[model samples]
Target: MFLAMRAAVEETLAATLDRLGYPTDDLGIEQPPDDIDAVLASSAAFRLAGEAGAPPPKVAAEIADAFDAADCQYIDRVDTQGPYLNFWPSEQYFEHVLETGQDDDYGALPDRETSVVVEHTSANPTGPVHVGRARNPIIGDAVANLLDYAGYDVERHYYVNDAGRQIATFTWAYETFDESELPEPERESPEYEMVRYYRKANTYLEDEADEAEIEAAEAEIQSIMQGLEAGDEAAYERVSEVVDTVLDGMYATLKRLPATFDEFVKETRFMRDGSTDDVIERLKETEYAVYDEDAWQLDLPDIDKNLVFVRGDGTSLYTTRDLAHHEWKFDNFDEAVTVLGEDHELQARQLKSALEILGNDTDRLQTVHYSWVTLPEGGMSTREGTGVDLDDLLDEAIARAREEVEDRLDDRIRDDDLTEDDIDRIAHQVGIGAVRYDIVSKQPTKGITFEWERALDFEAQSAPYVQYVHARASGILAEATDGEGINADQAVTELDSRALDTPSERELLRQIARFPAVIETAADDLHPHAVATYTREFAEAFNAFYRECPVLDAPADKQGARLALVVAARQTIGNALDVLGIEAPDSM
Candidate 1:
């Protein structure tokens, strides 16, 4: 079934035909028509027959004879009808390839330390994470996993914005609440509860609020940020204390969902090390910086926006500090990408140009804007503390999913048997899988409105469906009395091509063959959903095949072949799911 390997086989065929004097260099290969008996059809010899003053039928027969004598074992029959050469997979090869992926790297690229540092899950340290930040790590982790599988040196990192004014509000609000009095259960999640603390602080400030206090508070926050950036030991210690309190709670939930980072780049460190200050002076020397209103701005005339670099008060703009950070990444790796929300479009461009202004290499710095559309909640704001906490959503998902699983199994077991901790882990897997699947399944540019049912459903094109399929395969493999686990012999077939004439079986073969190609395209485009979509399609095909062709009770040869097909399909779907940051559970 090398012909099922499609493109590569076509090129190989074209070269052979060309050497055999087919009077055509346009010899191409294609899959058979949707319902056709042949695996593929070629038109080159037929198309050039008239020019060569020969009958196309006779020319096609000659080409078919050449292929028949070749190394490929799949094509059993080659027939010419007018200007076409059609080849059908020999039954043996077709069934053999079904149980195994072809012998190629499956388009896996090599790692020469060609690294990508992905900065993701940079939720502002003001409150707990929510669906808004959910897609960030889902997408980031998926991309990271895909890059690693494709042989890239990928380091996942988080640029924690703990030094910003947002943290000041988080700290100021927590102090207002004296949250120490809260019950242990509530106190366990200081980050999530900080929203209430923020609300109390805002209510108190509302009575005495004015532009002066607002500006004064803004200045104090900026001062804190600068001190943290400037490596002021006292400021670092103070801010880290408050930030860590919330960060600890936040990290606990993030770890539960498994959003990890190789490094945590503190925004304060970017300033404290004088990197931003150094970048600004460098920009000034290159005339990229201009003094306006006693504030230095990075001139972006070509893009028609004068980006503020350093304020009139001599503090760095977000863009200036970001420039220093990117420079740091460029020094460390050959490439770096960012998984940011769509709101950062302008910021991305400004950051890149500012890097250019600072005389840093921007070409090797690859930036990916892994954007997600926010649901209609007026977006996350640190002051109001209104967006839903991701932990809450995860907690709810875990409870619901565990209930669903229990309902399906051990109907008589007491609820006590499912301990809170047991339900927590089960929920963590299904809940996070649901959240991750919902985002990864959608197109990156589509804006989403949060819907609970859509995130958790097993019948829909969601994580549950794919995970169930994997579990199904595991179930079948478990039932086997220690048959040789799927190995290279999936390439050996006991079934015939005529047996695969049915539409569903053909579709399964088509999808299995396209696995390598689909991944190659996805990796090149950095579109994780490509893999997501493929997983669904393959699963659908398998389901269809299952309904039509019973696997477990078939004849010995047929059952074994079907099991091989199951193994291939399961492995492929698992690989695709991994690239989308979804897990394949052994049991539903």
Candidate 2:
């Protein structure tokens, strides 16, 4: 929706400069700062100020004059600010900004339409998902959605490490321990049972009661894993049972969280299909890999750590499976994205270098390490069964959201109006939104200390606030729908501005019109937080407008026009939410 306007603006600027005898190619511009009230701003003329051998203010004034002389019909006024120039939209231009985007192709970009694969939330299937693991999918799903929205043929994937020792231990511990297996739920966390068993396994190992017994258990697990890797029919089926069982419950919790993957790749598949060996050979043949002491290692070119890809026994490590995985992705997608936590920075970076080592075009694959902030409380370790379990976190978020809503609305909403269905819907929206938006509201590189007050604040840029704005827009439209809704081609007046006469109204229009640009920026940077931040900007603008501009109580013709404006604003915001894989319920 914004592509056309951007092109038109740039083209008009270029044409205006060319007609005025300035070199258009050398001149560049950017959208004005959001904090400012200007329509457009740039310092292009600043570059030529010294060449013109005149004062910067004089140069800026001349360029501004030249731009104003151009026949572009959308701009209201142009002003010079020393070396910078600014453009302000006329009220008519504000109306045009709404109607202007009707035919705009905002979503699709030139980089889209080719299939891209993103592997995210590929948690060790030993236990439930954790808060750290949640970051990957929260970001990955948004990335995939952005790519798709931007017109890329995209696929979301989860690489299951079903053959890993972690799974073997988890399965081993589960089968060996019966009713007594569950650990003491001292603190009663979400993963109380799982954590209990994990601690039990460690405790058993630490006791050193019987070396033979412990060795026997290890051998049994290895045999099972080896069988699955070697395509043993029974072993594969057995492993699948465990995977299916955990995945069923895991996916259930994830569904509530609302992130999904289209494909689930198994690490064992590499072993069964012999691709893992092929990748190992390719790495060894090239000078990219070397036999280091006993293990197979990537050279890493001295810029980073030499990565261990395989053990001396030829057992595949995470890096080995990843090498094979990248080969698969390169053959399958035009782009591949890896959203992982910060702890694996070295390993993930080495994985990319390993791909470059194994004869794949480094340019063909774009690997992004979307590192997330870890809770300062602790980190999750399989052996210790520690960290924040995602299932538990989500449950807590929902419970908190429910309590918050029910706490306030209990008196107003009677037994007849407030039902399970309504509560669930609201809780889910706010709970999930709170989680997603919490991280998304900040740059991913920045750490977040989870705070309940911030997460559930309905007045903050948190989920509830934005969702409330969406609901408010709907309520206004509901009252107007009795006889109002502008026809498809209804004409709007220059004076109407849709009751957009206040500072807030102007701000709202600017924000509504800026949605496409914001989305494009977010997509380009692979940053969903940009979109999140924009949602708050838009919501704040809507609130301010709501507070000052009387949409429903304005002149009837003007009120109807303003309703149309609100509809467009709501639509644009909804679309933004959709791009983030969020739902803006019509009634919130």
Q: 206-282, model 1: which lDDT tens digit per residue?
A: 76568887676666666676676567887788777777776777778777666777887877777877787788888
Tell me the spans in candidate 1 whose CA falls farther than 4 Å from its real position: 1-7, 13-113, 169-187, 193-222, 370-382, 406-428, 482-503
How many pairs of residues in model 2 come into backbone collision? 3
Name the lDDT of candidate 1. 0.68
- Measured by TM-score, how close is model 2 to the native structure? 0.89
What are the lDDT figures for the candidates, one per model?
A: 0.68, 0.71
Predicted structure with the largest lDDT when compared to the true one? 2
Across 56-81, the per-residue lDDT of candidate 2 in tens digits comes to: 78888887877752455566667876
Instruction: Flag regions of model 2 displaced more than 4 Å.
Output: 16-26, 68-70, 90-93, 100-111, 174-200, 370-382, 410-420, 483-499, 585-588
